[model samples]
Every structure is written in structure tokens, then in C-alpha cells.
Target: MEHIEPVISVKGLSFRYRMSETVILNDISFDIFPGELVGIVGASGSGKSTLCLCLKGLIPHAIHGEMNGDIWVLGQNTREVPTEKLAVDVGMVFQDPESQIIGLTVIEDLAFGPENLEHPPEEILNRMLPILDKVKLQGFLNRETYKMSGGQKQRLAIANALMMQPKVLILDEPTSELDPIGKEEVYSTILELKKNGVTVVLVDHAIEEMAEIADRILVIEEGKLKYDDTPKNHFQSPEKFLEKGWLRIPQIAEALHALKGKDLLSEKYVTPFEEEAISTLSAWLGRESNVQFTVD
Candidate 1:
């Protein structure tokens, strides 16, 4: 089988809000391959949001900041590429949906990104329906944008980004403001995007949710790239995260850790899902039911 190349690459990346200010991203580097769902977790002010901005070519183009690094999304250097040109390949949905949305109706909002790219109206109409359905917004095309609930607006924001059919989607804290149902809708859309081979970068404090879906996890702290590993590997050694309190282990992982403290669990057992943990516990209980041990 042939190896797939990375779609996004960063090398020696460092960014500061101002020339004299403290660095937000300090010499961090990583790569994301196509069709990967990557999660970024960190405390507030740890540069998770700033890194998202850099991924989409907005740092030097739309926002003013001191940047020293190379960021290539879909093979174009972010520093040299125009934001408009990059937008064709990268779409970003922010934490606040209202800030990025401007159309009066859902259809209008979905049409904005495509229309600005000079796509004809008929072509846009042809593409809009399926895109709305992708986000589970099929019946909401004519609804007023402002009147939709928080989750709906967030999904619409994602739909607006998807309208352009970008190769990579960047979502910054996309589910932070949503309730459980709203978060479920948002996360389902994310999984669907991944299924369709669109690269996804999600930044959020929802570690449990990320552990459920992310192909890989990146933990940043104090303007540095701290841990970049699989979710299972990262959580197996929770001390790294617990030491600084920059990241949180999923509650399910905590329960499993507690189980491992006893002699029932294998010394090498590791998993992040509650269902898997339950299965393991059930099997252990069934086998141990016939055996009794005396305390030493």
C-alpha cells in the first residue's frame, strides 16, 4: 500500500501577539494527514485558538501578529499564500457562530462562501441542498439565521464553510456553547466529515468527546507542543496531564485507572471507551466469580 502524504505541515512555528509580547506558540511543529480527525487540547491562553488561525492562513493575512514559522495547508505556504486563495482549500468555523455568519436566512448564509468565489448561482443551488443535509439541516434552508438555536447556528456555520468544499476543515471550540443534544449533533457532523475524507482539526476542552473520535491528539501547554500521541497512549500515562493540569483525562479513563489499581485488571490493559471498559470489567467478574483469594 502506498503511504499518504500529510495535508497540513508546520515547522519551527512560533507566534506572538506583538513584537514585545510573550509568545503564544513557541517553536511547535506537527503534521496532519488527509482524512484524519485531530484534536487539540489546552488551557485557555495556551495558543490552541492561535494555532487554528495559523492553519487557515489568517494570521498574517487577516490578523496582525508576530509570526516566525512555516505553515503549509494542502501544500501552499500559509505565510505567502493569500487568505482568499487559501480559503478555497481550508474552511474555519469559530466558537461563536454569530460572529462568522451574516446572511438573513440559512440558504443565504450557505450561499455566501460559494458566491464570493464567483461560482454561478445555479451551481451554488445545486450544491447547497446536500451540504445542508450533511450537517443535518435539510429542512432549515429557509429558516431565519438569527432565530435558529445555538447548535443549529453552529451547524449552519459549518455548512457555510463546507459550501466551498475545502479540503481541510478547522473548527475552533465548535461545541463549547452547546448543550448535550447540540453537542451530539455537532459531533455527528464532524464524524460524517471524517467519513467523507475531509481533514478535520478541532480545538476544545471536551477531552472525553475528543477521545471518542479523534484519530490522534495533540496537547499544548504554556505556548509549547507538549504531547502529540494517540488518545489511548496519552491517557494511559495520565501523570503527564495531571502534573500541569493543562489537559483532563476522560472520566471513563479515570474509572478504568481505578479498576487497574486492583489485581483484577492486567498490568498492560489500556482503553478509552466506557463500553470497552464495561466489557472488560464484565469478563473479569465472570471469570473471577468462581475463584476466591485470601488476603496476604
Candidate 2:
């Protein structure tokens, strides 16, 4: 792989709510490259959301916190840049869709960010269609925000963030409140955003979906950056994370892991996706019953 330059870099970052408060992040540091979809998971109150806030310059700036170390986003120091300026480069969507949705109409919601930055009407209009298409909200541009379903509202919130065309997008538990179908819609949109070279930081409990979408996983434990590796490796060593009381790999991957590198299956199956695991098992069994196993 070619050396991709990091778009965001954190140097020895640590933060706490106040002098008397316990540290939420403890000397955490990492680099996020352009177009990378990074997934963060941990037990609740492990400083995951605080990390997101730090990335977007909310730490020690808008939110009063005792912060140490530096964060550089888009080649600019986040500590130096104003929150308004950082907002332009890093688009953030909170866990709750309703909290972010301010406009009565979809068009108004989508245009909210741009209008704040004082983007002209024509320029905003030109950007609308493309963004609407990106999130699959094309025909509902004029629909009422409250009338939309949980999924639609979530996508609309994402669309609102995309209106700025920010370099980085951070989402906190985007699908926590959505139904299964709503989760699928939001997950699909996240995958599409990765394809478009948008750096995304997702804090979610959907480990299965993370296996499908995240290029790399960042596991946090007690306000520390514990594991940073490809999802493949992360799932392969579930025992380590489990021992630390961090997170478990997807169920599908756990099933495959039990059979991985075993002669019982013709192929060494270690994927986390459900459909892929099923297919791999079927093919292996077919090879055993029908004919001799031939290496692909």
C-alpha cells in the first residue's frame, strides 16, 4: 500500500472535565488518514465520545475541559483554529437525529449548515441535489422533518452535515435509536461515504456492521487507546479484547473463528459477514461431499 498522509493527527492527548474530575482520555494519540472509515468501540463512559469531541475541536474550546497535548486537523492545529472554522472542515452528527435537526423542512435542514457559513443561495442550491443523492433523500427535499421516520431523520441529519462538504465526518452511535431497517439505511450511507473519500469516525455498538464498513477498528478501554488494527486482526484475537473487558467481535465472526484454521472446513474461514460465512461453509461442505478439495 502506498503511504497515505494522515489528515488528522493527535499528539499525547488527555482530557478531564475539571480539576477534581477523573480523566476521560489518558494520553491517547493516533492518526486518521484521508478517506478512512475508523470505528471506535468500548464500554460506556470510556471516553469514546470525548475523543470525537476532541477531534472536532470541542474539547477545551466550546466544552470546558482540562485538556493536554495537541490535535492537528486538515494540517491546522485544532487548538488554534476557532470552533466555527473547525466546523467547516469536520462535520459532526450526534447520536440523536432530532437533536441535530432544526429545520421544519428537509430543504431547510440541508441548507442550515451552508447558510450559517453564508454560502450564497445559488451555490447552496447547486450543492443540494448532489448531497441529497448521496444520502438517498432526493425526492423528500421539501418533506417535513418531524413527519420523517427514524431512518429518514437520521439520513437527513447526515445530509445536513454533508451540506458543508466537510473533510471529516464524526458520528456518535448513529443507529442506536433506529430500527433494523433504519440501521441498514444508515450503514449503507456510511459505506458510500467511505467510497467518496470522506474520513469518518464512527462511535457505535454495532460490531457486526463495523466489520462490514470500518477499514480499521480503534478499541478504547478506560480512556485509553487500547487496540488499533484492521478489523480482520481485531476479530481474529477476540480473546485479548474480551479479557480487557472491551468488546466482542461480531457473532458471525465468532462462529467462523471456532472453525478457522481447522481441517473441519476445507477453507480457513475468518470473515465477520454473515452471508460470506454461510457461503464459505457451504462451499467447503460441498467440496467434501461432492468431490476432492482443490485449492483455489
Candidate 3:
């Protein structure tokens, strides 16, 4: 079977601001399939945002930068395509939801994209309503954007981006400012997008949450791709990754790391939170004869 072309492809990518000598991204390369939900995780200055910016043609076009590489989004070479043109192919949601809102009312903001394409006004109306429903922001259509809560604002941001009907969506720390409920809402929205066949590239430091949603995880440290693997493997062997000191591991995994020497604990290392709790209870219940506790 022939392989279908990727939605986003990067090769030999490197970038540096005109004012700075340091390169933010090294010779990085990767590809995103049509419907895969991938997460890029790293420290503050690890170039997660920079790499994401490049996917949407924001690095060299919007920001003055020395860029050396090739990036293709929706089959168009990012280097040759204008940012405004790429906007139709790839949509981006930044860390701050407030920065994305523009029009006074939610419906108008959502309508902005299709209208620009000179789509028939009725057709724009047809597209806008469903997107509003998809994001569950229909009630806010006539309401003022400023009056909405932070979570509502973020959903509005997503609604606006979806209004464009882009094939790829790039989100940077999308849930960083959201509360627990808000974060869960955003994650559910992402899963919905994936189900609708949208390619999602999520950049955030929440490894556990990302692991639950992402099909693959790419680790970037000091502006380079360090480790790219399945979330299960990354967490299953904590010490191995900790030795690299690049990727972030879950807290439970870290606890398991420190318990490696406690023969019984090491024998049944847990993966997820529920698994850990059950394992601990089983060991303490005296179900296993070899299990024993000691004080140092």
C-alpha cells in the first residue's frame, strides 16, 4: 500500500533570532500524520514553542529569524507560502486565550475566517453554527467575548480557529491557565478534534495528561529532539530517562524510581495512579509471602 502524504513534515530545521547568536532549534526533523495527536514537551526554553511556531510559518514570516530547513504543512512548503496563506491550512492557539479574541461578539469572531475566503454569506453561516456547536460555545454566539470566563475564552479561541476548517491545529500550552475542570474541557475538545480527523500538535509540560491523549510524545531539551517514544515506555522505565535529565517524568514514576531498592516494591512497579494504589494495597495485604518491610 502506498503511504499517504503527511500533514506536517519538518527536516533539518534550525532557527535563531536576528538579534541573537544562539540557535533555538537544532537540526530537528519530524513528521505528523493526518490524524495523530502528538505532544511536544520540554523545559521553558527547550524550543517547544519555537518548533510549533515554525509549523505555522510564524518563525521566519512574522518574527525576524535566521531559518535553515524545510517545513511542509498541508503539502505546501512553509518557506515559500505566506503566513496569511498558511493560516488556512494550519490554525494556532497560543498560551493566552485573551490574546486570540478579536471581534466584539463570539459569532462575528467565528465568522471572520470563512467570510475572508469570500465564501457566500449563507455558506459562512452554515459553517459557523456547526463549529460553535462542536466547541459547545453556541450560547456565547451573541454574547460579548470579554464577559466570558477564562475557559469560555479558550473555547472561543478554539471555536475561532476551527471556523477556518484548517487541516492541522497547533496549540501551545492551551490549558496552562485553565483550572482543573477547564483543563479537562480542553482535553476533551482536543479528543473531539482528533475524532473529526484533525491533526493535532499539542505543546505543554503536563506529561501525564499529555500521555493520556497523545499517540506519540517528542522530548525536546536545549532546542533539540532528545527522545521520541510512546508514553508508556517513557514512564515504565523512569531511571533510564532520568539519566538523560531531559524529558519530564510523572510524579508516581519518580516515586517508583526511589523505591527500586525495596525488593518487594521493585518487583511490582506501577505505571498509572490507580495501578500504584492497587499494587501497594496488594503488597501490604500479605497476599505475597516474600513481601516484608524494614526500617533503615
Q: Tell how far residue 169 is off in model 2, in angstroms.
A: 1.1
Candidate 3 whole-model C-alpha lDDT, 0 to 1: 0.81
TM-score of each: 0.91, 0.87, 0.85
What is the lDDT for 243 in model 3? 80
lDDT string for model 3 (114-169, tens) is: 88888888888788887778666776679998898887888888878887877899
Top candidate (TM-score): 1
Which consecutive 10 residues in model 2 have the weakest lDDT in total?
A: 287-296
lDDT of 2 at 43: 91
What lDDT tens digits, residue by residue, belong to model 1 across residues 4-115? 7789999999988855578889999999999999999988888888899899888978887889989888889998889999999899998788999899998888888888
lDDT of 2 at 90: 94
Clashing pairs in 2: none
Give the candidate order by descending TM-score.
1, 2, 3
Clashes of each: 0, 0, 0
User: Which regions of candidate 3 fall more than 4 Å away from where they truly are?
Assistant: 133-136, 240-248, 256-261, 265-296
